[model samples]
Target: MSATGAIPVPPGKAGKAGKERFDAAGRRVLLVCVAGGFTTLIDQSVLNTSIPALRESLHAQPAHLQWIVAGYSLAFGLALIPGGRLGDVRGRKWFFVGGLALFTVVSLLSATATEPWALVVSRLLQGAGAGLVNSQMIGTLQDVFQGQLRARALGMYAVTGGLAFALGPPVGGAVLAAVGPEYGWRLTFLLNVPFGLATLWLAARHLPRPRPSARDADLDLVGLLLVGALTLALMLPFVQPPGWAGWLGFAVAAALLLGALAWWQRRFARAGGHPLIHPALTRSAPYALGTAVAMAQFGSSLAAGLVLAMFLQDGLGLSPLGAALVALPSAVAMGFASAVAWRVVARFGRRTVTAGMTGSALTMLTGGLVALWAPAGPLPWLLALLQLLGGASIGLMGASNQAFVLRHAPAEAAGVSGAILQMAQRIAAAVSISALSGVYLRATGGGGGHRAAFAWASGVCAAVAALAVLASVLAGRATAREEAAREESALAVTSNEPARESTRASG
Candidate 1:
């Protein structure tokens, strides 16, 4: 057994046998991870659709109800880094199976939940399990596939996840409607049991048992605590009553926690110990910049969708079903666009990213203008068109951005690199949602507010689009530099090899 707990085969049979075993393990891991993702999607989507039912049944206030949703996100976001590190240290297959088991049990408990708090706790546990599953997925992929094959597999993984996000709500709604309110919400949680069990069984039977490498480092418990604290502090304002005091407290707490985390990581690096995120990779311009762009893009996209849903239901007085129908265009566009994203990236290189971001910016600007100027006017199909355009742009840019980041990252830092990106995205989403929600509430005059909330949301969308454009420009420059460097390095190697061979012949 290797220090990392990976089983070492005899040299003669190692190459061929390892390849065969890895191939089998990859499929099983992928199945289980994807199944977990589906359940997470179902949990989020079903809750959103059944919120009204839940409120009526439990007599819950808006604040309490929001917690039901926010609890899951909070847990999921906070656990990501720790979970990824656990996979790195303890071996992925076990963590993957354990995560699924936890998810399944909690899901069953959630279905039987009688009160809001009970469901909220269950959702938190489910989210933690989801975090474990997601964090290890890409690491498993890396372990199983290599080079171009890896890229293709990762692309497919992204596509599957995008489709799940797009389809979740509609599927949840359909199931809920069919079963009625009494059984609908319960069905959402219970739906995972069969798939989870199947994944667990497959994993147990077919997954390779990775030898635990004693060389694996201990978990950075302090770093994990700080990260969890920082995340919670950042998200607190969103869940609590909005006030200067609440916001100020959250900000201070977040700043302290983040500052401590940074210090701890630096200390660990100086001591030659492995940190949760490697300092070298974290400090690299490509990783840092790519992570920033990803954060802003993901944050803005999620905020826009949530705000749009609110506008459709509260501002326009549309039914939940009507709002969902209106939002379908963007979801459909995202799903289809992601499949062809790799082709677009290859053809245009970084220019494609710039163009996509430009398109997104224009769409957001147009949507904002329409919202502000034609508040009560004719329902322009422009909203749908703009959404489609924005979705496609995001789909194209996101896939390429991920590839570029991973391509530049050092091999040993893969798990940390992935975790950093994921963390940025989660933090961005949480902040954007809170900020945008506040803006919407202020613009419209609270829960029973005005149509102006839509206008404000439109403005926020436009700002995000502008940021996307800037990110595209910066990312393009970085990609060009990277490509040029690669070419120069190849040329140098080619030139040196011939000279060395000639010297040897002469001698």
Candidate 2:
């Protein structure tokens, strides 16, 4: 109905105006989400290079140091699924705010802690908070964006995460250099405080209110418990690698827990409840293949990063700061590549993923050859150049792979799907980094030289990357086959329609 003497706007123009307004709002929201993601991810690795400083400052034992690293990750992996479900059921706005507030408070506590136990506990609580906020961030992106915009938004998200990981070491090293060891480590925790508070404010102002769930919504507690336990079982050995005997025990426990989880999910769904992970998601070919690709690439790529840092410091005798600087190109290139990755995805579909994985594999293999034979004077420069390409390759693979996998998630279960995909990547990084470290250490200890160790580790990463390439290829072929089948069915229906109409007319 129009007001008297006023004309009604054309429907198409009105719709375009509405869509433009919505998109502007979504972009503002995305900035807040990406900031939250960047904060937590940077914290994940920022402490690694500062471990020595922490040990000296806190008077910590080796065991305490180990816990300081392992505990945070343990809590993070445990919290993801449950946290995601909470956001799904409850509103994301309050949950995201509460989580960020918790993270901020805990960061302050960590900075002030005088005892090792206090710091350890603070880290655990902080990880839980981060896990909670991160789930909502991923969930919000899933809710707010669609089509190519969704892919591009997720690409930016990936860029931040990758950049955070790569930059953490350098960031920490710089802080330590700026301040003496006595205070350097404390400042790292303190750094999160200001950024967290700012992001929390933006989130409170800009994030959307969550839609209410049904009054009878079920959380599937049993499924949540199973998931948490299974995650611990699968992750513990990798984070703190054990003897072969202990490894066997954890592996067996993980397998049994997994079976139990699958059974429970199905039974719960049959009984008219929502499973934490939908059965259809587990059965989805695209999801399965995409996950495999993510795990392989994420684990191996991170392993290569860790190994490269070591090679620079140990193999090349560069200082920590120097090593970090040499590796900076890779991180910078990753962000650059991620910024434009969606354009390639628009053109190539899954082939973009395949191309990226192929590039990564080549980069790793080339790194190995260069490490073994490059002149000492030029080695660092040459390796840094290669790493630049490596980072871009990863950016392309990660952004495309994440968008593809998450799109397959049912709208109702988007949070769970994103959590699961991230979970796989985290677990894979733990295992692969541990395994690759052993390879490097073994070679170095046996007098095989750091050059050989770098070569060996790079070879392993390249092999895993090749596996990712294979998985991406298979996934793309499956999609093509499904599209062809759908087209054939549609054409058949159209061709038969005219004949059926004539017969009806004659009758």
Which candidate number has the best lDDT?
2
**Candidate 1: 10-residue stretch with minimal lDDT:** 1-10
- Give stretches of model 2 more than 4 Å off: 1-24, 51-74, 112-120, 145-151, 238-242, 368-376, 410-415, 437-456
- Writing each residue's lDDT as its tens digit, candidate 1 over 153-265 gives 66666666656655555555566567776777678778788878887887677655765666655667777777777876776676665588777877888888889999999
What local lDDT does model 2 show for residue 88?
73
Per-candidate TM-score against the hidden true structure: 0.84, 0.85
Please give, for residues 284-333, the per-residue lDDT of candidate 2 as tens digits: 66677888999899889767876776678668877656666777887788
Which 10 successive residues of model 2 have the least lDDT summed? 1-10
